[model samples]
Target: MTNDEKVRSIRSKIKCMKSTNEQGFDVIIWMRKRFLQSEAFVKNLKRIIDAGFIEKWTNYLNLQDISQRLLAREGAIKDPEIKFEEIKTIFVLLLVGHALAASVLILELWYSKRSRKY
Candidate 1:
């Protein structure tokens, strides 16, 4: 693509990436969990994500100011390799998240117990 075209593309993408108060990854997860537990759609997820997602995701991550430097709680570590990883890897995490929290908290409980063991 031409330089001008590329710039326009990037600018358009950036417009939709406000990470704070806009990016709703955690909210999405909460909705999904709620749905499976009660076999009901607890909330309208589309409205929760409509503002940012149809816009774009990675661009949203960039525009977020989530205070990455803040210390972790209990037992957590900020690994550089994990941060350097690309956004494409999120699909893998999605699969993992779905499997862990699909229709009930059983999978979640199992994973939590196992994760702590290691």
Candidate 2:
């Protein structure tokens, strides 16, 4: 299949998966099992990245992360052990730090641009 067709297929699969009743860990696991970990999907992902669609993939990951966290907490109530608390906590902290670092870089870029306008 062409790269565009591959991308469309991957996106459609993701949309269908997100529409399912599964949430958080289950959704992630299912996606990994069904699509994300597949060779075809990886190839398509690399093609998309090479085609300069990084922002689209980044947005998708951000959305998936939000969905996972929102449902993960609810899932934890039913089975606390399923949450993997320590790992989740570390992952969250790392994400926060990454966001902070990105924000700082963006601010620096903005300041530099503004200074150049003077």
Q: Give the top-scoring candidate (TM-score).
A: 2
lDDT tens digits by residue: candidate 1, 1-118: 5433433443344444345555533221222322443222212333434466555565545544443423343334556574535766797888888976774688777878889953
Score each candidate by Cα lDDT.
0.48, 0.61
Query: Which 10 successive residues of model 1 have the least lDDT summed?
Result: 25-34
lDDT of 2 by residue, 61-118 (tens): 7687778788888885354455577589889999999999999999999999989953
lDDT over C-alpha atoms for residue 55 of model 1: 54
Q: 107 in model 1: Cα distance from truth in Å?
A: 68
Candidate 2 segments whose C-alpha is farther than 4 A from its true place: 1-83
What is candidate 1's CA lDDT for residue 101?
78
